[model samples]
Target: MSTTVAEVPDAHGPTPAGSDGEELPTRPTPRRSTLGQRMRREWQMHVFILPGVLFFSLFAYIPLLGNVVAFQDFSAFRGIFGSQWVGLQNFANLFTDDEVLRAVANTLIISLLQIAFVFPAPIILALFLNSLIGERIKRVIQTIVYLPHFISWVIVIAIWQKVLGGAGPVAELLDLLGMHGVNIMTDPDTFKVLVVSQVIWKDIGWGTIIFFAAIAAIPTELYESAATDGAGSWRRMWHITLPGLVPVISLLLILTVGNLLTVGFEQLQLQQPAVGADAAQVLDTFVYFRGIAGGDWGLSAAAGLLKGVIATLLVIAANRIAKRLGTGGIF
Candidate 1:
């Protein structure tokens, strides 16, 4: 055949591996750094947390050793080391003590009321605040609500006393209306209600901060799409916003449950003189009155230890329940 011009590979065509008579080298894998090396590299971060560690050790953790006094006939003169170990006698005494039992009942009652009423106050307020159309009005209202949180409880109690005490305006108005003025601050029958109300007013604004942040994190697109699909303000909030807040709400609820036995000591202590111990006594006040004020150190410690154990157990149970319900808890 008149030789057809032999087909030839283009000069720039792909070449097979080793076709050029050279082998490509493989890359070496990187080695992982040792723990020591990692620690050295992140040493600055360790330094930053060191002060917090020291502070907690000094003020929080180290003091835990004092809980041992619960089992001892502890004396200030003999000290923790030299004290007589009375075992569970102190605990037995706690169960038998009417004051302790009453304190427990009062604590549970107040805590339950707070959990039911005060806990939801912030959620409702945050939702209401977020729905405001005017930014200036919303901000002004937020400032007013937030101011009470910063004021000391002393001032807060005083303010409430001035507003609800027998000679206060509401009381005066009631008196003028034919119903005699009553001192709400000192009323045993309604002390629990007053406590819950004070707590709601004081912390609701501050508590809403987390919920508001949660609301902000929700994708704006969800609300816009919902609106485009004919959803109203309440519908958008109910469907989109409320679901976004479940996590924060669950976390706070679990924490609140954990603190069931520990009511506000200073708050109750201050009002106890006016309302009497039967209405105002709680676990915290029980401990204070028994241990420091009454010099029943062992009994106080036992009550404290029991409170701590129950709180820890409550946290664990709440965490488990939250996990089962599909909202993660603050473990």
Candidate 2:
């Protein structure tokens, strides 16, 4: 009889059947979980943020629905649901109103002045404080400066009036010296200066806290190395300190541009009567006087809506520009 030869299978050959001649099924790959399933799995993590989410939904987002008033001839009597739709009539009127135009102009000018002068005050103060050698003196100065920020606007205005008002100490001293005291409080030409100065004085120190923190984060080794290499104080600040601060400066610049139309409402409103509306009216004051006080609810709502839209656009544009310049932005 001839000997029978069994054939051997290659490594890449198809899977063999079992001894009983049955093929086993291959295991299926796992699929990703759906969003709902993921949310369920992470439910506990989300619970921590639930209160904040609810708060914003209630106060910030839900109230946005009220912007419908901008498109309607809104009436207090008829209410939001019952108001007659007027399309763009309110917005048309807003653009045509001379007082509204003037308010926009004043708002722009004051915002520009603040950006140019007041915005940098805090940075300068932070730099000065950071340069100090004594931590105790730095803490004391910081406390004194930050105190003004916590004071109420009413008290702040009152303090300003006492110091610079027509019959205040400066005026009294000027009278004794037979010299004319400058009327800073009521002068339209000087109102811009006064407002910017007040902002710097009130918030400069508080604003510096962030900058101080940024400066402190810089490694002392870098400064010591720079000094060892014969680099002067100004050179180190220019090369390292300012470069480190560029990201922060860029972020703040974008925010400042976004708020270019919103100079302090309370500050402007408090002093408006003293200097007259022509000198002090801003978008906020315009909304208050035209809407709440004057009862032209729809028109004022249109103005406010416009301001918000412009601010949003400004933020978007500024972020884009910052990105182009290679500075990271606040998204």
| Over 4 Å off, model 1 | 1-34
lDDT of 1 at 277: 91
The TM-scores, one per candidate, come to 0.90, 0.89
State the lDDT of candidate 2 residue by residue for 40-113, as single tens digits: 99999789889999999999999999999999998999999999999999989987899999999999999999
Q: What is the lDDT of candidate 1?
A: 0.92
lDDT (Cα, 0-100) at 220 in candidate 2: 86
lDDT of 1 by residue, 191-308 (tens): 9999999999999899889999999999999999999999999999999999999999999999999999988888899899999999999999988988898888999999999999
Best by lDDT: 1
| Per-candidate clashes, comma-separated | 0, 0
Worst 10 residues of 2 by lDDT: 9-18
